[model samples]
Target: MFLIFPVLSYGNNITLDEMLNMIDIKNFDKKIYDLEIEKNLSKEKFYNLDSYNGVKGEADIKYDYDKDKYDTNGKLTYGDFYVNISKNKISNDIDNGDSEIICGINKNLKNIIYSKSDSELKKLDYLKMKDKFYYLDKLESKKIDLINLYEEYKNNEFETKLKSNNLSKLKTEEKILKKSYELGAIPKIDLQTLQVSRENLEIELKILDKNLKKIKDRFLYEFNIDISNKTLADIQVKQIDISKYIPNIGERYLQSLDLDRKITIENINYLSYSNKVPDISLGIERKKETHNNTNSENRIFLKVSKDLFYYDVNLENEKINLAQQNINYRKENEKNISNQLKIQENYNNFYRNYIINKNKANLESNKYEIMKKKYTLGNITYVEVMDVFEDYLKFEVEAEKAKNLFNGYIYEIMVRGEKNHE
Candidate 1:
């Protein structure tokens, strides 16, 4: 006996859990996110060197030709060469070769201090990219969609068989009705109406068959498994406790936003100290002279400078306003999370309702089987049997649709909801 829901003994079959486990990490979106994290890590290295520039080297050489004493006093003069360990360059005296070489190393103290905040921001960005839950949630959602597609295909396959059976029965009825009309016991219009009904059903069946093949092909392409002879195991719905379903605000969007807030705070702190620190450079000068005798002298010096007209004059105001902006952003995100949780509750309720629908469909299916038997035994009219069949089919289709919805909601909550379900 064929049942509405049955375990088919097919040569090949796969469970939903098994199919989900078959997810190839190579094809997963998380790999792309990992690349992004690596890129951010490289940025962190760049921020580490933001305060220092490489040594700037300079050299000069000249010939001091005394035209007045051209016969005997003309002399070759060698200029000094020095490496300045700073961003700025010192010019050499190409005209006289008397240039003093100031080979010094200096650093902007403010840049070293500001680099901390830059490094902190990059690190926060790296952490945000490294969090894998977002990609995982998306993967889970995709799996749910594939499951639903398979379930729908299975239901359509069953419906096509049922319609074929009905068409066969109608063909028999038409044969009987045509003979009755010839015998003047039935009207010609009755036979004609049955023929029209049969034609319409054939068209519908054709469309269903086309859709079945399309779905089968899609499933094979996606999972690399031919499900033509396979059936998906029923989706198991987990009982959820909404009261205990506290969403993890530290995994995906909320986590990223919070990191952004931290980065902003770091920037604001850096701005507060930016003006207090001046550009300070400490270096030594080495001078060489070749006027009459070669001589060298070394001297150490300290340089301090501040921007009289600070480029970021509004930095203090920006620091004050940025904190308020961050607070507002966090508040909006929290509100959005709250709204999503409420929608999740609605999804949970829908899944529960579908569970009841599946049970009702089973009962109606049994009733339909009994009615068909009575019609075969001549205890019920053909029309009466068809009415019961229609009701049964309605429930069956609804139950099938509900199954997909049930699975979708369960998976969504388990993977993306407040609790870590997987």
Candidate 2:
């Protein structure tokens, strides 16, 4: 922690507890988790190439920087030399071929970073780490919602069963109609209406069954785990304290931070190895005194020259600026994600209270069942009972939906928010 504090502002030093505090996750799916592992493999491969780029040698042709000093004519001369230099930084000279060659070679080595993505392959496996984490977060949220829905459903199932008993009332009403017809107190037309109404209740119960089945299938599909993929033993349901398992937000943040640090180290390798040079260049020069010297006198001089700063400081600065900018961009993105998490927290709290309260309020309802019995006994009319049945089913679904939402909010706080905190 002390070592890393110097490199970053605010000393983004963290521990497991801090990480746990920042993350909110309720579930983990197999497929998304697998994809995240794959993404890490790819990133690790990307960073591995840094070693090659960091050690590449550059071929440099040394000519007199002050060209006027070398007055070599069209004679055969061993006056020019070339040596490979491993220049590690950017070059100032726009016309410098050696620097260009170095850049080209480095680019060639790191070509995989920008290479064409096989659309089909990428589509099949183009999972980014961030995207995988986000996908998992969304699924967790949705799962929580469905689970809550299931909770309300299970909680209020008694009421729904009670509502379905309206079928008995309809049967009783049909009997009354039949008796009235036999007594000549009403026409047979009323019997037809009563029978049809009885059948409609049967149809509605079937529809409810179908809907519950769909909801179950949806849960299994999203989690990428079969809800039917349970143990053979009839396991007793155990209560879980959701807060105990809310996850360390700070830990997730640090894991992501570690990945980022590795990436940064890899990226910096190309810059680090830009200024390497081989041995030295030795050349011979002829200095001719022009005081009647072209006619008779020639002085031979041995000259040795080496590139003092193989990498151009100005060019290197530009590259450094670009690299720094990229680093800054990623940091900014992380900041945006953190801010969004802050906004989401309040929303979760708000929805939790409202929805959970709605769930509890509807849990002990027997109004539907009681009304159904009264209607069958000729104590209540059809119109009077309709709202009672409807409210029972509506609130059952509403409660479940709310519980899941509350679960999702908690997940976001622990999982999604950790990405930034780490």
Identify the leading candidate in terms of TM-score: 1
lDDT of 2 by residue, 70-141 (tens): 222222211132222222222444432211110111122222333222222232233354455456455545
Compared with the true structure, model 2 gives a TM-score of 0.42
Tens-place lDDT per residue, model 1, 1-422, is: 12322222334656665666564333436556677678767766666545343433343333335432111122221222234221111234233323233343445455555656474666566465435556655666666667677667767866787778878988998898788779986556656766776787799899999999889777666545566777666565567654444454233656556655666566666766666677676656665544445777887767798766666746666676677768877787778677767756777677776887789889988988897688557676555655676677678777776776766556555555444423
Provide the clashing-pair count of each candidate structure. 1, 37
Off by over 4 Å in 2: 1-200, 211-258, 269-273, 276-380, 404-422
lDDT of each: 0.61, 0.46
Q: What's the CA RMSD for each of the models?
A: 8.6, 16.2
TM agreement with the true structure for every prediction = 0.70, 0.42
